[model samples]
Target: MSLTDSEILLLEQLIHDREVDKLFSRLTTITEETNPNYKLLFEAINSQKWGFNDKNRPVV
Candidate 1:
């Protein structure tokens, strides 16, 4: 299958968002308190409803 230019851009943005989510997760893990920034990032990561395969059945 082929992706259009807009689809490709969306895919790129999703990948970048996932990377940022990973970074936030790691930072949150290392930090002691669940500060506002960490809470916001955690919520943003959890709020994402896409990026998972059939077997995963959860946020990616």
Candidate 2:
């Protein structure tokens, strides 16, 4: 199956948002000098998400 232009754009936006969410979460922890949110911490990062597991589910 093929995605239309808008679907592709939305997919790109979702990926970007997920990455930004985790980055912001990480930054907040760093600024506070505290432990990370383990749930977010354990989820495969952007680089690893594709191959990590349960490939059907979206990364965020």
Candidate 3:
């Protein structure tokens, strides 16, 4: 699925604006896994998971 220039521009703008939720909503059904913004989107989605220590370890 090739995105037109306008779509590319919007994606870029979303990345620039850090509009993660809006971007994620728009990208939900995307077929282009290699889209350049994918990494940025994935990072944005996972950005808040870095400080979690819930590793599911059993406690005595």
True-structure RMSD, every candidate? 11.7, 12.1, 13.6
| Top candidate (lDDT) | 1
Residue 11 in model 3: shift from native, Å? 0.2
lDDT of 1: 0.81
Please give the ranking of all candidate structures by lDDT, highest first, separated by commas. 1, 3, 2
In candidate 3, position 13 carries an lDDT of 89
Q: Candidate 2: which stretches are off by over 4 Å?
A: 30-60
The true-versus-predicted C-alpha distance at residue 7 of model 2, in Å, is 0.2
Candidate 3 Cα RMSD (Å): 13.6
> What are the models' TM-scores?
0.48, 0.48, 0.30
User: Model 3 off-target regions past 4 Å?
Assistant: 19-60
Candidate 1 lDDT by residue in tens digits, 1-60: 999999999999999999999987777673556587767887898788776677876554
On the 0 to 100 scale, the lDDT of residue 12 in model 1 is 100
- Report the lDDT of model 3 for residue 58: 44
**Which digits, one per residue and each the tens of the lDDT, describe model 3 over residues 1-60?**
899999999999888778777676766644665586876786677665434347865433
TM-score of 3: 0.30
- Cα misplacement distance, residue 7 of candidate 3 (Å): 0.1
Better of 1 and 2 by lDDT: 1
